[model samples]
Target: MHDFDLHAPEGANKKKRIIGRGQGSGRGTTAGKGNKGQQSRSGGKTYLGFEGGQMPLYRRLAHRGFSNYPFKKTVQVVNLVEIEKRYENGETVEPGTLLVKGLVKGANPVKILGDGDLTKKLSFKLVAVSASAKEKIEKVGGTVVSNETVGND
Candidate 1:
């Protein structure tokens, strides 16, 4: 077809329904919102879980059980392989050093995990060490100074 013959397909460009213009427009006055009460007035929509003058389901049911999420402790973990890559032979590995080295972040406690080999004789302070990781650190002449226990033995 020629460029001048181009035209939109039928029903593809229908005009939007004009509402609340005047009574002669058919959709005017009420604009399909129907007569009066909550929905008819401005900002009169009911909130979610709202029931018509009765107790809502969320309110009728008992709020049961306790949550330990509020008292839960969050710990940041680092592996031995990462320490061997970032730290020197005699340098200390702690939360602050780990943060500076981009191994861990935030103020949460740090826990070292024994995932790979460690050769440097480093010192660990103010951090927790897993049972397996502690053995690995001591074997490499590294020292772990914290008494805070991490995961289950």
Candidate 2:
């Protein structure tokens, strides 16, 4: 009972190294894929973005992110006759006085949209105030100041 479970046990089913059939059988001639390049012939494939030619791993990697229009938030518009041709009825149009009067370009969040006309009773301390610009700024008696008591909202 030794030879472990006897019979074909020690090197089970021998004889499958039968390559290209010739060079006296030791994995025959180039059947072990060596010499004469391109992996020794016969359907040898390697060329559609191949890497053995050095520069290919998607051309050796270096191009990423955004192929256009996935992130769109460039909303910066103000009206109500451009805040009564620039504040002065109670002056308080915040976002640091609309970036010291050049009206917008970073304070990052200022929405105010109502599109034209208002006789000035101005006072917004703003950060997002539309509904026809808070109904034309409370129909021209103006007084917005409510961004939930300015908790950086």
TM-score of each: 0.63, 0.29
Compose the digit string of candidate 1's lDDT tens values, residues 33-98: 999888988899888988897999999999999999999989888889999899999999888889
What's the lDDT of the predicted structure labeled candidate 1? 0.88
After TM-score superposition, what is the CA distance of residue 90 in candidate 1 from its true location, in Å?
A: 1.3
Measured with C-alpha atoms, the lDDT of residue 96 in candidate 2 is: 84
Write the residue-wise lDDT of candidate 2 on 1-153 in tens digits: 666665656777776566879878777777788899777887878978887878887867789876768765665666667777888888888788887888888757777777777788887875677777777788989888746332211
Question: In the order shown, what is each candidate's alpha-carbon RMSD?
Answer: 6.5, 12.4
Error of 2 at 69 (Å): 11
Worst 10 residues of 2 by lDDT: 144-153
Clash pairs, candidate 1, are none
